[model samples]
Target: MTTLEQLLDLPRFSDLEILSAHKNLERKVESVEITETPDVANFIPKNAIVLTTAMIYKDDQSKMKHLLDTLVSKDVAALGIKVGRFIDDIDQDVVDYASKVDVPIVKVPSSQPLGRLLYQMLSYIWDAKTEQLTYALDIQKRFSGLLMHDVNLSRFIAELGKIINAPVILLSPWHKVISNSQYFSRSDHPASFYIEQIDDHHYDKINEGNSSFIVKDLKGENVQVLGYPVNVDTYFPFHLIILKPEQIPYPVSEFAIEQAILVLTFILFKNYKVDEFFDIMKSDFLSQLIKAKTDQTHDHRNWVDLGSRYGLVHSKYYRLALAYCVPNKDNKTKLIYRQEEAAIAKKWLEAQLPLRIKNVIIFKVKNTNEIALLFQSQEPDANKVLQTLADELKEALSIQLCFAFGNPYEAITNISSSFIEAKSALDEATRLFNPNVVNYYHPKGLVGLFENTNEESIHYYCEKILKDLAYPNDQSQKELRNTLKHYLDYNCEITKTATALYLHRNTIKYRIKQCEKLLGLSVKDPENSLNLRLALELSESGNESSEQAEPGA
Candidate 1:
């Protein structure tokens, strides 16, 4: 608690004094006020010691009476009269009128300057304020440990508010109320209320270079509002601070407020660090789990945590996906900028998607130009999302993407299967169809037919089919390749193959005979024809180019 003696000791009031003559009268001074007009009575602040000179109505008795009437109406604490050159003697009429009105008038002599008296009063008020602030600071320091113990903001703010004898409210940058001390009447409002207050125009004032303080008069309220900018960082999406009384007689300890704000800022930052630590733990755990389940080696396959690569873990959902960029034409060049491209793709996706899609994770798989994403979604539209991602990659990166979407599995255990399916679908897309965009469920129709075919058998059959078509002449080789493709395609039916190839039935029969002679195989036998046809299909599909060498070459 601040004492009156402490208030008098403030340096700001070092030069002024309360007249002993007036002090001896045994009158109480409740509050302090400063004004210029003689009509001070009309606007005398409540419980205030009115400070003014009679210069405004030195000769007018009616004006003095009106002023006295106003002061009486306001229930002023006392009247302070500054008597300098303007009033050489205490006006008998004024003193008589004031006495009649029962308004105590303290004479301020010419020898004692009005400025010095005002300064003394101000100093006294400030000294008391400083003492109160010192007490608050002491309380804050003592309670610092409690604050550090993860106490909710409301409790902390309430304690601070009690010490200051003022209401305290916490607000985000958008003016959303977080918590309030006991003094505030209301504690809750619509979320949109806060959002509406955070206008872009105000950002400059709040987020300008470093820290700032401003006093504003809210249009509807008579209370003076002071705003303090909480300095975290440029990218800190939210700003937080407390609001309290603006200009009460209670001294504001700027230092105490600064220290309190610093402590709060530290708490917020610490929370962020803890969150980040947990997110990294979660991401690493998931990545390792997938890696273990797949038995992925360092060379052949690996999982990547996209969330960590691009700060996606800071978002509400921790999600990502993976896409592989396989080489064509037997080239082994690794995909360059796979991670960088994924980041770019992620940004593009963000632009295209609705603002509600706040969290997206992306990363590049090791040893492969495969981008992985852990998409975070509350309710996902998989097809639309996939198409959007594919379109963006195609348009911006110009790189065809094979998106392997994992199930929206909440746990690490189920993710591996989704990942495997996506990878299989991606591989099939690269091998049998366009690599631009493919989903795991897309090639379901072909899964049944190709399920039993081994990699080696498929390679061998494709090689043999191409080998039988290698003719001595380029034109004849082309002709034979076309003929074999049609014959195998038509299930070895001479009529259908001939018709499909736009040739006479005899011509097709002759080509088959020629093919049988060259390959030394029975083209008419079912078992032999199946082998030939399988080989033809693989060779035509271009998977056996390296194995199927040209004849005589």
Candidate 2:
């Protein structure tokens, strides 16, 4: 119960009359003394209504002045002066002083005992208490009913506004107006205008345990504002309830309006979860669409073989890629709803990009990092699709992104290769001196190493080079192999390859020449160079050792 109600309910104040007096009368009675000594002034509480006879004053001018000074300092609520006990008549000076000071002074005649007056005062106090309690209980019941009935948030807010007799507005964490009550709408008020008027900095200041009141100018008019943070243990960081017409005495009842807002927030969050449930169902449906599209082109039997070869039948292929985009500091900074937003972003990618890509994934890699477009797609222009996806993502999410396109292979057997190449391309893209899209297979300086060549042949070439380096008295063999491997790895960038091996440009040139002389093949001729490298790799393998050793046994 409120302090006023508690004071009114006290039995000692049963006969109290709450005088409808001006500030002058209140100040007059506030100066009247009920205690003999000025020290007792300190004993009176701030809100206490003191009743007394003027015996303490004794009608001495100096003594009366001293008593009044003490009473004023103590801030007594209302002073009831018993007039007939000593003075036989109410003093004109006291009455005039009480009126001037705006204190309600009751003229208690001697015929009316002090006990009877006290009884009447206490009864009046009890009635006021009952009235306030009734009002508070009614408000509580209304809120409880709203909660139990699962009232819509908008309607609930409107009802609360009516209860408080003020205009109310609810804003999302983004400061976007979600709902308001009827009173606000009826007052020629523009909802968007108020939403825009809200200071974002102030909105951010709200938390579960804090509330504040402020005066703000809205659309040319000053409004009293009481804003409280609504905390609901759900997806939203906070729900804001704003009240206007600050004069409305938001009673200091512990049954805060935030309790109502929190309940509404829960309902809204539950509904949002339901919406997300449907979104996931849609995502699953899109995944099926991608699988169906791919199935039309490749035989199912091939998938089985690929899966078996790669030991990936049970491996859920969550196709994924990484991309760099322009940072949206605002949206990115308040990155709530991560999983839901990612799911939606994935669907958006599928709808906008080529249908061949499936299971597209987009998620935050770090504060400024982006991981995007993990899906199964077999478009020949998969790299182009990745670029388009980055563009769409920038447009949709308001962020610019750089993409690393994983290989679009039909079978899971090649996922490892695709992931490695994609990662390398991503690294290359990040490190490139120029601004251009980079793909795994189309790396600027390293394309030759990753060309569509037989894996066995490539492995054989590495083996041959290593074997040749181990030969007796072949001092140039190691340098030659290093040069070839670096050249292949860097796609023939003389600067990069030489730098990588910590060798001078001239040294790299000399090694290449040595490799040509030893292999009897043109080092620069693409076909001849590949054949020589393959042969070298095969020669390094120990299969020939077993054959030679067996014959000797």
Q: Estimate each model's TM-score.
A: 0.44, 0.45
Model 1 bad stretches (over 4 Å)? 1-140, 163-178, 183-195, 209-219, 222-225, 229-234, 241-244, 247-249, 296-414, 420-496, 504-553
lDDT of 2 at 240: 54
Query: Model 1: how far is 220 from its true place, Å?
Result: 3.6
Q: Rate the local accuracy (lDDT) of all candidates.
A: 0.56, 0.53
- The digit string of per-residue lDDT tens for model 1 on 313-426 reads 332333345665433443334333444344344434444544434455444444444656656555456556667656655643354556655545654344566566566666
Worst 10 residues of 2 by lDDT: 544-553
Error of 1 at 429 (Å): 16
RMSD in Å for model 2:
13.6
Stretches of model 2 off by over 4 angstroms after superposition: 1-151, 195-201, 218-221, 233-236, 245-256, 286-465, 468-475, 478-553
Q: What lDDT tens digits, residue by residue, belong to model 2 across residues 73-174?
A: 656555665566766655566556655554445555566666665555556545645665666677767777876787777877788777777777776543
TM-score of 2: 0.45
